[model samples]
Target: GDSTTPDAIRTRTLTEETARVFRSRVVNPRWIAGMRKHGYKGAFELAATVDYLFGFDATAGVVPDWMYATLAETYVLDKENQDFLKHANPWALHAMVEKLSEAADRGLWSEPDPELMDQLQQVYLDVEGDLEDRVS
Candidate 1:
């Protein structure tokens, strides 16, 4: 019976309703505080710092596919959100690629728009390249 609801519709509705709340309550305040303390300029930088401080599994090289898929479905679909990710640190951006790859592998989330995926992938590559250059 419950199968009557389409996955895309459910996901879109859930994300639209909760995205603002999640950003305001979970993301923004902490970002503002971090900006004050660490000079993070935007959402991407803040996400990277938070990921670094919390030591997300990707830091340990153990990315969970379902989690990444969920993140993409919930957070990465919007242009503004994707822009925030563009400025993310290398590790964080790499984690996004890993997540998206995992989603692709498992067919977990709906297919993201091709352009959005391309943009995110480009950002990931740019950040990774920058990090590599710094190390070299």
Candidate 2:
């Protein structure tokens, strides 16, 4: 039967291709326009600003699990937990949608369920831990 597998593959390919475009169209221009966007005076400031949203250079090729987790976690975090997302990598649309679906299923957006919150928090922490291990 026709299934979501093919759609998933197509989505993955599209995400990778568009990420390259984002690097050129979004990342590049963000640097050029840094003075307006972040009041930055030079490349250093622009680089640091983009670093938060784009992840490290190596992560460009890998899917960003952290962004998806951030979206899921956002529904459950207290103010302190939200602060953790500043370090999250920007995830592809595919991952974000998947996480959003899971978050919805767990009712994270509709209610303050502690069990679901724990699950989302663990996912976020795990992704960060994995990234750290890979980088180190």
Candidate 3:
């Protein structure tokens, strides 16, 4: 952080780095497509990553509301992506949506769009219902 020249001082903190990586990887279409190629395990990784994200935010207070929205819009809500998760691993689908719902409920997504959150709630219920059908 400290540097001889004022201009040379490092500017990015762990918060920025975390957000950057999340945008480049998690919300990147190419990365999502790549994950789709890996099938069940790929979906599992995505779901698990959300858990890690939530945990990190719980401790660091760095995750922005937009990041959660991106995860929902780009990953969970997109039809192709949702279908991929469904066929590859419905459990992962359920797990991921559950985490998102928890995040919103906990105020991580403090000012989420009403329409978007409404859709997410419906998706969560549908995913849970899908799981219920399989086990029953």
The model with the greatest lDDT is: 3
Ranking 1 against 3 by lDDT, winner:
3
- For candidate 3, write residues 31-77 as lDDT tens digits: 98899999999999889888988998888878899998988887789
List, residue by residue over 15-110, the lDDT tens digit for candidate 2.
Answer: 565455445643353433442343323323333433433343234433244433443443224333233232333122123333444544544333
Instruction: Using TM-score as the measure, name the better of candidate 1 and candidate 3.
Output: 3
Cα lDDT, all candidates: 0.49, 0.40, 0.86
Q: Pairs clashing in candidate 2? A: none
How does candidate 3 fare on TM-score? 0.88
Give the Å shift of residue 13 in candidate 1: 15
The residue-by-residue lDDT of candidate 1 on 1-136, one tens digit each, is 1245577343344334344434564345464445434432444554543343223333443333444444554344445555455444445546656556544555443455566567557766776787788799
Question: Model 1 — TM-score against the truth?
Answer: 0.43
Best by TM-score: 3
**What does the lDDT read for residue 37 in candidate 2?**
40
